[model samples]
Target: MRYAVALAVAMAGLQAMPAQGAGQRETGLEETLAQRCDAAAASPFDRDRPSGVPGVPSHEIDPAIAIPACMAAVRAAPEVPRLWYQLARADLAARRFDEFRDMAARAEALGHAGGAHALGQSHEAGHHGARDLAAARRLYEKAADAGFAPAMVDLGVMLEDGTGGTADVAAANAWYLKAAEAGEVAAMNLLGDNLVAGNGIGRDAALGARWYRRAADKGDGFAMASLGLLLELGNGVPRNMKEANAWYRKSAVAGNRRGMRLLALNLETGNGLERDPRGAVSWYKRAIEAGDVMSMRLISFSYFNGTGVPKDPQEGLYWLRKAAEAGDPAAMVTLGLRYTAGSNVPLDFERGLGWLRKAAEQGEPRAEAALAVLGDAPPGRSACRSVLGDYHALDARYGALPARFSGTLPAFRAVCAGFPGLKEDDVRRCHLLNPDGAGDFVRRVRKQCR
Candidate 1:
């Protein structure tokens, strides 16, 4: 899963300002235009536009016309900070970092915080330059002090992470509260997260859900995703899978990867939506493209079982190992078992145990069982004792062998052939599609087969 920012650090973006320009003019000509646009056309600056850029959202603007129009407007009003800021926004969106910096600096020097905020975002993300968290925090502070709500959210993140200075949880929550009070949707989401975790605020899931709903109403994808989680888990709210799926759909539509993942998983299982393997795969692919590494492992499992795609063990192992190496703990556990059992490759106990160690270090409780096979203790025994309930669930689900797990059927029969009261198939389906039940069968071998 992506970091919340606990997760991803993206705070908020700059909203368009109402001011157009101060009405000044400059000379220069058609040679200055970058990207695709005609110099003769006027910039599309509409004062009445309530949201987005002057007249249209960035996505609606024709790239062939945007840069040229903004350049013409800047030339027509050289000293206008608003015009410079607009061009800077356009430049930054177009990935023209040098031009963006120059224009944004000019607008910032003229006392416009929008340009400064954009520049600070670039610094925070280290776009087209070295990462400089200190510089980013300072720039964000400048913009926030100038009454920029988005900057307040960004500053709070830096403070929370100690990016520019000492980690100050209370101060971070304060900034988030300030921006939320000012009606910044992203700030509301951050503040809600803090409250839910009691990081710097009181732990209150009800209050957190309220804040999430408020931001969701304002069309914030992160907030929508958070609200969906609360609704789905009944955390300070009644469990309503249908409502949760609706919110997940909204969040996914708004480009939230976490939402896309959950919606995809739900679609696959018919949890709240109709089971549509193809649709699930589509959403999974989208989330994967958006940098959701965990999706790789899930998609790989689908491939292995031919649940949502063609059964291709080679391709499945490829993706599974890739994700595991990328530090996905569940993937690591699966890969560990694969190596240990020589499922698709030669058996390599040492290497398999090494994979388990990596997953264990990452606090994957599941990895502890496989680690125990190597006689590694303290950590293993403690991990097992801590997750006794999980082990119970594992045993209850896979204590007996099912016909579907044909690959491990021989081993299961040999070990549990005469064992009484172990017959079960109702919960055996889990063994068919997932690696989670591997431990239950393995424990039987270590005990009876020996």
Candidate 2:
């Protein structure tokens, strides 16, 4: 990231001259001293020397002067690995990629401890020149072998995806473990994922949750979202919708799109809490604004059905089109329905059939039924009726019954007798279908039965 200098300046005291016997000896000594000085100046690991008075000669000089002095110092004392590293770093800063590589190679050959890591990072980033993943990997491995945890993590990532060599999940896991033990936040997240997914290790959801919690507590947004999802799904922990909601809220507030979507669903459905349609709409809007495709689909559904807000067919069609363009199967189906019904638009059989065919190709049942109906009027009607029967059957199993029907005493009696798995939360959500207490007759039956 450092800016490269375009020009080099000679030191005021050291002038270029023809080398004779004695003169060459003096020049070599002066060059060696200059190289040593430059090396010392370039070392980031060392404390910087105090600045000298203006116009005064000192160990620390402007880089233009310091570079030549350091070259001279290296000429005089060529065995110093630190000096070689300094020269290499200087060349790197000056955007002299080839020279930096050569100097770094020399520094490494001289057994410089830190230069390898820097060289690896530079190559990995392509900072001073062209990217060389192979070279970066080699140097990273060397540094990791030298007990550098950062290098171990970087090497692990490279190996995990086969960036510079063959994929080695086991090796990647080992390196991640090493870095995690050394307190690397990124490595901890990777290790947790590996453990959770059973990659290069046995699946241990509990252990994964523990690690995710640790990283989440440390402000890792991905970890927070991961942990929240597990809690919501009752994976590796007792299902606690309240805790899941809390965590989702945390991540959503922190700009997590998934969290925003889930929170919206929970609010809309009154899952594990009081229902808040307005709150649901707000969260859905946020998720949609954040570019969550599913959220856009849900928003379109809401508008189409007049759920939680006034119906706006135009808005519904607009969002449906957006979601369909994003390749959402459900959106394609909805679009096909809109075109077929001529809702807020002209009825176009061809357009409707085209959209239906697209959805049917993706195995959408409604689309398939629509396509069958369009093919042969009578047979299609029969096929559609059969499909509708199947669809309603599936809906009864997974979806809530309408509140109006459930509010009838006889209907309530039938449901309570037939479906023992219905929870209070499910019943409460059903009430929201009417959004009014007009369904209180059903409550009377329950109270009388009790």
Candidate 3:
């Protein structure tokens, strides 16, 4: 995650130079800070490496070497928080969980507070050998208490999810606010979502947009997606399809799956850009491979319609089945239709009814209508609840959303232009409006364009 990387880079800043000796030695803290800033400004993605590596290594290196260098540096200067933090990185990469924990402990003992926070992350990631969420929580709490920005986010996530603890939306919001105040970009996005959704916070679309923009500016992909959605739908900001597309493109280039899917749609339909079905297909494939259910559904549709790729009934059916199995309501409805029509698969009333029931339970109006046509009552509403449970299961296996943004216009523009049938007037009307209204608008756009 970008949040983790940014925190690591921040800690590295504190390690760039050795501290002063007791009496005569000069403290190079300021010089170290300047050097770190210069390096970060030059290339934010570059990871710090050992001096032993030749040829000015420009990219991230293997954790094995980096950890040792950090450990050696810490041995030479135990009080340096950066060295401890760097060592932890190496240990995490090398899968030396116990060592990382021990090193983090040592760093904390030596007054390197950030080390404690990094240690918590390692625990959460099950670095080294074993999973230990309790240990991670303890370390997260310790780091949060020590005023570390990332720790606040980490603690907030844990509380929000009730992972390794009880769910506490209030506590989560407090931690998110603290992290936001400390300039943690991901926390800003999370806080924005909470504000917009009225989850443990009063609804505030404008404030939500503001927070999303802050994270988007910092190159957070999800934030870019959220901001683009807001702008495109006119929620808390002026409706601007061009701006929305630009943000989507920005997020897509940064490896956001939803952005890629949206961008693909734009390419296929020429919403704000020139139509390019081949390019759209490429983007859609990428998103599908990354486990976006909507992408899967779109891919199936494309196959069925012979839009970008050659028409293949089998392929269409396969993708539709994949989406349905993954709990996509539209996919379930489509499958039901296919069964009812005896198209692409055998005509079986029992199977058709089963799929229709699944879709209807999830509140698919089409499925409900089809059931009515078949002289059957709509399935139980409990199916709607099951949809959310299924969504969580899928999200856990595949990442939920894009995690970073590139902050480029081409990227953003793609997302804005991708969703079809989005009128300029509709976009303008949703800006800075009520959250419920904004959400409804987004749903309308998604349903129509998708």
Candidate 4:
């Protein structure tokens, strides 16, 4: 939400004329930086290509080499804001806060868009002082208005998050669209997010897919993962788990945490790739190291099932508690079950019920079910105990145990007989077994036409 995106968006200042010899012959800081850029281009280890290219960089100069040359160039042309901008970049690379701040501010005062953007980055990051959202916004606005695409995206993020002012999702989306049109790849991904979520716009999955494609084509990792999710779910495209897995792998290689989690899931489930529990565990651990709580929950499941690592219910319980404590409602309900059933932990009714209540407060459906069934029941109600057992057993059959699954209400009435006011299809109830000794189908769905 900080209106300070990557500083690599500019270094040698805005495209200063062309990279030709005639343009470089002019005596100014731009020429000096231009020449330095050419030197960098000649090096196999360095690059300066910007926009819509994979495995390329935007302003990939050796800050160390550019530092001394930029310092001298600034000395020669103190009035040229671009020279001061380059000096500021060098100062930033060297961690020279006082000089960086001073030069960046001076360049901004002298009408340099990149300088304004640089100062915004510093303010947003609290590099030279305390974080200043207000200053960051003002500087970013100026730079964005001056046609800095990165600043436009940063400003949009701040507007959407309401960090610097009141949240205006519509305005935020507008800025994202602007930046996306201007070829800011990150903005393309963000614009897709806005479209999909209907944040300041009507929810349009096709439009979201379009923008995601644009960014993903540019090899943006976030866009790749997002598009993969859409493809996997058939949200705005066909369900193609194979293609989804490919994108997930690409995004993971690009270091996207969500990509790592998704790839781990595919590996765990053998959905589009060969099942590799150890590989799944490895990716989950990587995602956890990057602070993904969702991965923590999945990793707990691996431990519990002995799918990736050795089966260790104790370690599973440990991770479940950690995930629950970290605010995963599903894990919270699972933890509550652990305490309630004492299957993996001690049965402490009060504590277990308390955990369930907390999870229910967060709108976890399984927690609500637990409360409805056992809120007031102690260990001695034989009917309630039997019903709860049947409920869980059905879920286990359907592979969603501890998670709510649908059931036919008439079947429930036939089993729990005289249950009041229940007369509809139920996605909330578990499947019931036939009371008949023959074990034939009862109220379960018989066939699928499609």
**Which is the better candidate, 2 or 3, if ranked by lDDT?**
3
**Candidate 3 error regions (>4 Å):** 1-65, 78-82, 95-98, 109-111, 126-135, 326-329, 352-450
Cα lDDT tens digits, model 2, 1-450, are 112231223333344545568967676766556444644455422212123412222223345544455555566567767566666656655556777777777777876644686678778878666789998999989977876666778899999999988889899999988877766667888888888899888898888888888877877666777787788777787788889888888878888777887777778768776887778878889988888887777776567657687888788778778887887666676666556545555766568667878878888665765455454333323322232222222222122223323332223323333333334654564454334432453353343323
The lDDT for every candidate, in the order shown, is 0.66, 0.64, 0.65, 0.68
- Tens-digit lDDT string for candidate 4 (1-450): 111122233433444435556545546545555455334322121112222223213346455565655554565457767667666766676677778788789878888887898899889988766899999998989888887777888999999999877888898899899989978888898899878888889998889999988988887888999999888877878889899999999998888888998889789767679999899999989989988887777888788768789999889788878888999777776677667667567767677778879988998765777677667664654343344433432332223222234344234334333333233333223223322211222222211000
Q: Which stretches in model 1 have alpha-carbon errors above 4 Å?
A: 1-64, 125-129, 273-278, 375-450
How well does candidate 4 score on lDDT at residue 231? 85
Against the true structure, what is every candidate's RMSD? 10.8, 11.8, 12.7, 8.7
Ranking under lDDT, best-scoring first?
4, 1, 3, 2
- Shift in Å, residue 427, candidate 3: 24
Instruction: Give the candidate number with the greatest lDDT.
Output: 4
**By TM-score, how accurate is candidate 4?**
0.72
Error of 1 at 286 (Å): 3.4
Off by over 4 Å in 4: 1-30, 37-69, 87-100, 127-130, 349-375, 381-450
lDDT of 3 by residue, 134-248 (tens): 8888888887887777788899999998887888988999999998987778799899999889898888888999999998897877888888878866778888879988988
Candidate 4 colliding pairs: 406-427
Best by TM-score: 4
